[model samples]
Target: MKILIIEDEKDMLQNMQDTLVKQGYIVESASDLDSAISKVGVYDYDCILLDINLPDGSGMDILNFLKKNDKTEGVIIVSARNSLDDRIRGLNTGADDYIAKPFHMAELNARVKALLRRKNFEGSDLLKIGNLCIDSEKHTSTTQHGEMELNRKEFDILTYLATNQDRLVSKSALAEHVWGDHIDQADNFEFIYSQIKNLRKKLKEVKADIEIKAVYGIGYKLTLS
Candidate 1:
């Protein structure tokens, strides 16, 4: 998943990035409101961690902007303002969850996962398609026959496919979701093709009946036998 951390504290920003990256998430950081606004406009993130206090402006402004734009990105307010009213205000302004300052990293991670489940998977951690099972929390995939470990990109591709199972997902959509803003500079989508190939191979090896079908002029779709 992709995440945006809008925090002014350099140390806190790095900590959040490190924690999320270790869990196989793509993370971007912005220390002020301007940068956060710019990044939000150009990039797509599954979730955003916003601090209520920033050097330039209140993080609430960013949340309000996102609401006004009709952006459906998940949002969590992480701030030192532990007052009940502050938390209430954040939620009322469109924040999905609130995390007070001095919180444990584990809790933060849990909250993020919860928010993602609520937004994308109907609050389920395990995604099932026929005999194949994907555990979003463990980042693992298994079939009735056996289980196989997937690399980061492969896992990402599989997850994206599973989420949109039975629907045609365009190559450009995969490129944008997987590679994020970096896809603009890429020369070709060979890497995406390779990832899909590897993912299909792994599933087949495990005797999984799931199939990824190419759409020729379009993209691909995940179909179950």
Candidate 2:
């Protein structure tokens, strides 16, 4: 999953990014409102951690922008304001959840997971397709045959492809989803192709029920075999 942390506090932002990275999420961050707005406008995210008090504008405006644009990314407001009106206002503004500062990272991670489940997996930790089961919480994929050992990018690629199973996913879309802002640094998709090749071999070894089929002019698709 990809997360955008919109926080002005340098230490706090770094801490949150680092924590999520360790949890196996692709993370990007911005410290001010403009940067935050730009990111939310362009990129797709599984979840967004927003700070209400930004350097230039209120995070409420960010929430409003997301709603106005009809973006469906799950948002959790992380703010210092603990007032009833603030909480009510945030929830009413279409935020999925709210967390106050001085919060534990573990609890924050838990809330993020819960929101992702509700948004992406229909409130389940396990995302299953055919015989393959992906424990998004544990970041593990397995089949009836056994566990499928995969690197971070490989697992992320499989998850992304599986999420859009049977649909032809463009290479740009897959690269952006898996690498976040870092994808801009790559000149071509050889890196992505390499990961998909490895994932396909692993699936074959486990005798999995799905296959990653490449489309010559476009990209790849995951189909049940």
- By summed lDDT, which 10 consecutive residues of candidate 2 come out lowest? 179-188
Kindly list the per-residue Cα lDDT of model 1 for residues 2-104, writing each as its tens digit.
8899999988888898998888787878999999999888777899999999999999999988988888889999999999999999999999999998988
Candidate 2 Cα deviation (angstroms), residue 10: 1.5
Residue 139, candidate 1: Cα error in Å is: 1.9
Whole-model lDDT per candidate: 0.89, 0.91
How many Å off is the CA of 101 in candidate 1? 1.1
What lDDT is reached at residue 37 by model 2? 87
- Model 2, residue 67: C-alpha shift (Å): 1.5
Residue pairs in candidate 2 whose N, alpha carbon or C atoms collide under 3 angstroms: none
Best by lDDT: 2
The positional error of residue 122 in candidate 2, measured at the CA in angstroms, is: 1.4
* Candidate 1 TM-score over all chains jointly: 0.91
lDDT of 2 by residue, 80-128 (tens): 9989899999999989999999899999999999998988788998888
Error of 2 at 198 (Å): 1.2
